[model samples]
Target: MDETVTAVIDDVVARAAAHDADEPDRLRRWRVLEPDAGRLLWFLVQSSGARDVVEIGTSHGVSTLWLADAVRSTGGHLSSVDADPDVQDAALANLVRAGLDAHVTFGTGDGGAALAGLDEQSVDLLFLDAERTEYPGWWPHPVRVLRPGGVLVVDNAFSHADEVAPLAALIDEHPGLTSTTVAVGKGELLALRSR
Candidate 1:
């Protein structure tokens, strides 16, 4: 990340932190990914050399920016999905400000629908940070869309353990993937499809 991009990210993180702190209702908060988690996303994309990446949520685009930068580094592309058009707009603006808008494609509507629209075994990396309860129902899509050797990352594993438990269990039991948890930021649950 360049100094300019770093500055933009720092601004976004600070603003999001303030928003989260000021908002009394959890549902109304920005709920941006922690900076550590953002760095993890960047690392995963660079290390895996992921070319076609999908992100299930775009809240203010903190995670999206991190993923977009990584894709920019790899000369890849990121497809980001968010149910709320307004939030997606905010994310888009952030990406543009960071000069990373060119690296991303925004999908506004149901995250499941967006995932369903993708071709089978096409994506190199899939990141899930949307509504937790919906994850179990979105299964097989993640299973189907990820190419062999693809990566799956779900955020808030430890912070929202109960909410993400069922999906975690599903991933754990999948015969074709190996899974583990990383205690970063909100805690990330990572899995890789067998090559």
Candidate 2:
């Protein structure tokens, strides 16, 4: 990564770490994206020229805030979904703190159901970080919603490798998508829709 990109990732990590340490409740079950994960996410968004992004998990809004920042810089918009209302509220507050409220739209409820309501091929980027075991269930909807040449980023893919086998198989069999798994911050799978 370039120096400029490195600096941005550092800044984001610093902020997230500070906030995570301050809020014990928020840190309980939440695993905020580390610096490398954040950098990869930022790179993916920028490289894909993704304007309309969807995030499946919004725990404390750290990753949400990161995505919001990318969207704001790209003059894009982010639709973030979380099942927990409290986490959603925290995410909203974090975005506001980052001065990114205008770029993000929050949906609080069942992430799968919320995503199902979106139009097919409407999302340019999809970030999955919800229930680890239910990843396959939540995987297809985002895949269907992403336009050609869009990207799908699934977190914890390797950590829950056995559970996500079906998803891994789908990615392997599907000709329209190519996937790469990176072991960063609990492992992330990046699937790009073939052009």
Candidate 3:
């Protein structure tokens, strides 16, 4: 990331933190990804040379910005999904401010619907940071769309353990996936599909 991008990310992170603090209801807040996790996403996209990236949650676009920035360098693209149009708008504005909007496509709808529409085994990286409870219902799509050797990253693994455990366990036990948990921001359950 360049100085300009770094500045933009810092600004967004500050704004999101304030927004989240002011919102009493957790659902109403913009739960931005931690900087370290965002950087990890950026590095993964670039190092893997991922040409197709999908992000399930785009709160304030902090994670989207990081992904898009990485894809910009790799000549790839990022598709970000969020159910809330207003949140997606905020994310889009942030992306535009960072000059990374061109690298992303926004989808405002049910994440499962968005995932179902993707071609089988077409995605290189799938990041899940949406509602934990809904992950189980969306399980089939993620498993179907991720190519062999593709990565699946689930956020809030440790933070919201009970809510995400079912999906995490499924991934961990799946015959086609090799999975592990990492103590990053909120914890991340990472998996790679068998080739």
Candidate 4:
């Protein structure tokens, strides 16, 4: 990462850590994105000039906050989905505290189904951080909704490499996308549309 970007990520992590410390319940339930992972996500959004980002999971809004901040900087918007209402409520509070409420929209329901309902070619950035084992099932719909040249970021792709193998294979078979696996936080697979 560039020095300026590194500094920004450090600041974001410091803020997130402080917030997490202030809320023990949230800290217990959600793992805030490590500095590097947060930086990567921020970089992706800025690089892509993404105006509409979709996130499949919003645990305690840690990643949500990170993405929202990046989107706000770019004058973009974020829509996140999570099945747990409690988690969504907590995430909402976190986003509010972060002053990122204006940039975010939260949906409560099955992530896959929620994503499927979105209009095609509507999202600029799609992030998957939900159940690892359900990645394949959750991935296709998001890809379908992404516009040509959109980016898909899948978290825990390396940690759950076995579970993600099929998805990886599919990506490998597809000529329209290119992916890179990074060992950030848990692990992240970033697939950018090449078509």
Candidate 5:
């Protein structure tokens, strides 16, 4: 990432931290992927030369910005999903601030519904950072939409192991997927579908 993008990410993250501190009791305000995890997401998109990325969860656009940065380089576009209009607006503003808004399309309401609407084998990268328990029920779409060799990155694997275990076990049962749990920012459950 360039200095400009770096500065924007740092500023956004700091502002988000402040907001969380100020609004301690807010429910949805509790979930922003750690900076290291965000960077890893960025690197994966960049290195894979992934053009079609579908990201579930656009919390404050922190992760979306990182993904948008890579998509911009790859001449790709990102369709990011979030259920809250306010959060979507905040994410849109942040993307515009970073000059990455052109690389993204924002969807509001029912992320799972949005995800289910995708075409088969249409995605190059699928990033799951939404509800933990809801993941298992939402599994089939990613499995269908993600092309062979696509990367599936699930957030909060270790941090929310119990809640996300079913999805983890589901991945384990899929013979075509090779998986690993990496201890980087809330822990990521990374998997690659076989070709």
Candidate 6:
């Protein structure tokens, strides 16, 4: 990322941190990804040439800004979904401020339902930072929409391991994907969809 872009991202993150802290109740379950994790998300997307990415959570668009940096380069787009209208609106405003609005599409609703609505094999990357335990039930949608060799990233495996253990186990046991957990921010479960 360029210096100008980096500055924009930093400013946005700082603002989001304050906003989240103030209204903890409203955005409690929908926490922002750690700065370390945000950097990694940007690296993964930038390195992988993933054009079409779907993020399960978009709290104030902190993570989305990172993804957008890479998507902007590839001329691709990112679609992010969250259940709260207020949260979604906040994210949209943040994106606009960051000058990343052109690379993203914000949606309001369940992540699973949003993923199910996408075309099959259309997504190059699927990122989950929402409910970790419910990951299993939503597998089919990502599995169907994620292109072969596409990557799926699940956050909170280390920070909230017990809660996300079922998801890790299933990913490890699944036949169509290969996964490994990296010690990035909070630990990220990175998997590649194999045909």
Query: Candidate 5 on 70-163: residue-level lDDT in tens?
Result: 9999999999998778988988888888899999998887767887899988999999888777888887777788889898999998888998
- Tens-place lDDT per residue, model 6, 84-175, is 77877877877777788889888898888898799999999999988776777887776788899899998887999998887778778779
Displacement of the residue 184 alpha carbon in candidate 5, Å? 0.9
What TM-score fits each model? 0.97, 0.83, 0.97, 0.83, 0.95, 0.91
lDDT of the candidates, in the order given: 0.92, 0.77, 0.90, 0.79, 0.87, 0.83
Give per-residue lDDT, candidate 2, residue 10: 57
> Per-residue lDDT of 1-195 in model 2, one digit per residue for the tens?
334434444565666677667676833655666656766787778877789999988876767767877877778999988888887886676666556789988888888897789898898999888776666676567678889989988887777777667777787777889999998877888888874
Q: Predict model 2's lDDT versus the native.
A: 0.77
Deviating ranges (above 4 Å) for candidate 3: none
Which is the better candidate, 1 or 6, if ranked by TM-score? 1
Alpha carbon lDDT at 128, candidate 4? 85
Q: List pairs with backbone clashes in candidate 5.
A: none
Residue 165 C-alpha lDDT in model 4: 81
lDDT tens digits by residue: candidate 4, 1-195 = 234434444555666677677676743545556666777888889888999999988877768877988898889999999888887897787676667789999999888898889998899999888776676676667678888999988887777788778777777777778888989987998888866
Model 6 off-target regions past 4 Å? 18-30
Over all chains combined, what TM-score does candidate 5 have? 0.95
Residue-pair clashes per candidate: 0, 0, 0, 0, 0, 0
- Candidate 3 matches the true fold with a TM-score of 0.97
Which stretches in model 1 have alpha-carbon errors above 4 Å?
A: none
List the candidates ranked by lDDT, beginning with the highest.
Answer: 1, 3, 5, 6, 4, 2
After aligning candidate 1 to the native by TM-score, how far in Å is the CA of 117 from where it should be?
1.5
Residue pairs in collision within model 3: none
Q: How far is candidate 2 from the true structure (C-alpha RMSD, Å)?
A: 3.8
